[model samples]
Target chain A: MTQQKRKFGFETRMLHAGHIPDPVTGARAVPIYQTTSYVFEDTDKAAQLFELKQYGNIYTRINNPTNAVFEERIASLENGTGAVATASGMAAQFAVFMTLLEPGDEIVSSSHLYGGTKTQFTHTFKKLGVKAHFVDPTDMQAWERAITPKTRALYGETIGNPRGSVLDIEPLAALAHAHNVPLIVDSTFATPYLCRPLDWGADIVVHSATKFIGGHGSSIAGVLIDSGRFDFSSFPTIAAPDPAYHDLKFYETFGHYGFLMKARTVTVRDTGAALSPFNAFLLIQGLETLSVRMERHVQNAQAIAAFLAQHPKVAWVAYAGLPDNPYHALAQKYTPKGPGAVFTFGIKSDNARQAGKTFIESLHLFSHLANVGDARSLVIHPASTTHQQLSDAELEEAGIDAGMIRLSIGLETTEDLLWDLDQALQLT
Target chain B: MGSGPSLAVDVSMNTILSEADRAKYMDPGKIRAALSSTKTIAIVGLSPKPERPSYFVGTYLQYEGYRIIPVNPRATEILGEKAYPDLLSIPHPVDMVNVFRQPEECVEIAQHAVQIGAKTLWLQLRVVNFEAARIAEEAGLTVIMDRCVKIEHGRYSGSLHWVGMNTEIISARRGQRYF
Candidate 1:
């Protein structure tokens, strides 16, 4: 097989970068490697694979052919060295953190993040002795001051979950590099089609492929892509000799691919958060039409956000695509393609919780659910659903309000979504 | 709260340093020369505790074979080195006055670094003062702000890749030994 030389466009790469015709069966699409393990050619080959002397399929848990294609394709799209696919988006982020940090390490993360991620950072990571420092994403000094000697990573979302606050990746990356820490971006909202965080200097980008990457929301998958830029030599977890791999130095051995290799060989091998090949295949299908789907997604979202901002019943809209939004300039600087499709707006009513409930219940076109980045529109009341356990003060800290209605605009026509929202607001 | 406006002014001044000027100070060659040739580093605000960044970076620099002079008024000695009360109190010649102080304190330190005839003035990560940099640069000293010396050493000395940063260089094979 010959490697392609010319750099293809984003849409073209989305369709064709990682896979080619299968030589065995001449299959045109990515074939699911549904088996558990790969057979070794001989004892020498098996020993070489086990020793990290060579790279190939050893076990389905560590590496799968279909998942490898998905990984490569996403990495290419993200302009990264390589990627590791995991069972879910949360798992992908967990694996990357596992590879970068030890028990005593710390991460400075944005306050505006996915609810699931906040819970993981505040709860799960705390149990492992990893501390999370949450700071306002818009406050650069807060991020800087939060960095301590033990800080191993800086983390944020490309476009904040539900809030749609655009991250200033370049400045944040500069700050992280100044401290010799890597910036990890959760770019699930602004998928590579909208924004490539690595191009803005992020060291690693993770995604919940179950969302935008699996456009139809068919697969629960996630990926971790190494920007191949973060200098990790001073970073103990990736650079140091690991007893699990028989004292093999990952960075010394893999060079630019150290994180990807470690995440696969050590973290995935030990933790077992591998993505299934079938999910990888589904994600690949979503990847093929990502460019087109995202175009429609943005168009519909921009229109709905505009409509909501002007509505009499709407109290506030937080989409960065709006010219008046605080993150509008950041959106222009970072995600020039679009500010993304997920956003939230507050209902102007006295009984906001009841109003939000009525609005969501009345929306015939939008699906009231837990997920985003689907072909079908989604509506969720965070204060009533995802974040219901929190008190009023906690809700305020999470940037969620009782009246706030989170919308994940889909590929549906702008008129239909507007009608659904307008009728719902009237009902409320 | 009383220091808000002046700090804002300082940040604004720091932003005026253009990309080209910032690049001049942070040049890999310049960093390499500064790291390899400098023998003594006076670490201002070097903490006694192991958890502080000053202590951690100062220790790393010490391990890398530089003479680390801890500068703290409260501590008589730290990291097995005699701690000076100030840059002016260090009796011996200093190669670099590496500051771990706040941004507001840098201008005075830069002046002291110049008075002491130090070769370089290095502000640690998140400490940037354009006026201090100018004062030091005008006094014929190399000025590097908002960059960690330990990271620069790891990068230029070819040890950074061992941990996994791209370092923008690739090799067909891994043969050379690292520090």
Candidate 2:
């Protein structure tokens, strides 16, 4: 089964690519290994597993069989060496940072990022003595200029959160490579169907599996996919033995899986950020229909973006699918199929607070919660809700005005989504 | 566990000072004193709606033996108390004025809180005003920014629900359990 053909379309792969029937039980469905500790053959086998000489699970916190299947499936989907399943998207980002950075190191990242990611990079990492240099992800030169000697990675989203700006990954990846840094792309918005950043030159891909991957929004989880293209041996700090774990060098032990090994052993092991087996099971179920759901998501989003663009009340629309959008050209270059479900629009009203409130309150089908990327359409006024913590200047920098409304188009029919949106717009 | 001694000192200090002050000065003793002494609170923009955080927090504090004055211009009353239009309109003294308005409206609220002789200005979680916090602090009022009072109360009082593991055993019989 492991020797099966690798070439298959995403939908086929999503169902049966990386996984076969369970070896022991021959179960077609992935089994949930709810146990915490895995049994070893003997004492020597346990030592071997602990010493990284073998590759079987010792503990569920580090790895589990159920999660391994999910990891393999995601890794296969993203074209990565290995993947790590985490407790949440935030935990995934935390695991990545903990594995890659030391105190006083820096990350060159796009200024426009998810609110939680921005907070973690700007506020939380500051406590750890790691600095984040915010740069324009669209501007290749800004990325080049931001890379200093201590810059560890270049980070951006394939489609930026709320703003829906599509990043130009190929050139940005080249810039990162020139600086001896890896490019980490958050592909939560543009799931594997719309765009696979690895094919476009990204070294690492991250996702909030709670969003699209778990399509129903029933589970909160995240994944980190290592492309295995970045050479750890090129950077002495990452390759060298450390005080954190008994002087065992990551690169020396695991070649292509070096970063992933470090991420598993150090970050997930110590921080206890392992994904729940139940959540992994839910995510696997979601992946079965990912390709189909994503297509509908794109169809609905395109229709909504178009509807808003022509509306008299909408001052600006920032969906990449729209031809007049600033990100349309980059979207064509990177994600030509369609920008994933999320996009933002602005109301042309002075009483933005009232307009924003009315728009949200008037929506019948769209839920107005803090989360996005659900099977049902989601909407929020960024100026009053998601990006409310950011200052006016910071909001402007994030391309959010007081009247801006972020919509996460889901699997609903295009006509229904447009009708709901049109009535809401009329109310606004 | 190895850093238990240092962590104890840190927690003790944190008990006395506000989290914002601790982040600024690393003094926890001051936080504990401020918390213990604050008995009366005025919640600005306190909604009558039970679902809102302000309403629930105010109710929780009231249940915990603290006097709560709801201040909202739009509401005539909330939680059976006659709501004042602002802090200045309150008949009694307020120890802490909790501002639940947007960040842009915080400065005016902070000034009113000071004018009403409030001892501290508390901004709900995610509402930040550097200028307001600075002004309140300068006026000899304790200022806490981007923190939920109810969460802090629960955390400090050890009321947080813990799942997973129990180190100690609970027995109905006297000294019956053995490890």
The most accurate candidate by lDDT is 1
Could you give the fnat of all candidates in order? 0.00, 0.00
RMSD in angstroms, all models? 14.7, 27.0
The sequence of per-residue lDDT tens digits that candidate 2 reaches over residues A95-161 is 8888899898999999879989999999999999999999887778888888899999999999998
The residue-by-residue lDDT of candidate 1 on A1-428, one tens digit each, is 11112335777768765554443455667778899988888886686567654445788898877886787778778877678889999999999998888899999999989878999999999999999999999999999999999999999999988788888999999999999999999999999988999988899999999999999978899999897777777789888888876776777555567778899889988999989999999999999999999989998999999999999999999998899999999898887778989999999999888898999999999999999999999999987887788886888876678899989999988899999999999988
Q: What is each predicted model's overall lDDT from 0 to 1?
A: 0.81, 0.76
TM-score (C-alpha) between model 2 and the true structure: 0.68
Show the lowest summed lDDT stretch of 10 residues, model 1 chain A: A1-10
Q: DockQ for each candidate?
A: 0.01, 0.01
Q: What residue runs in model 2 are displaced by over 4 Å at the alpha carbon?
A: A1-6, A243-246, A387-398, B1-179
Q: Compute the lDDT of residue A191 as modeled in candidate 1.
A: 94
Backbone clash tally for model 1? 5
lDDT of 1 by residue, B4-30 (tens): 111100111112245565565555445
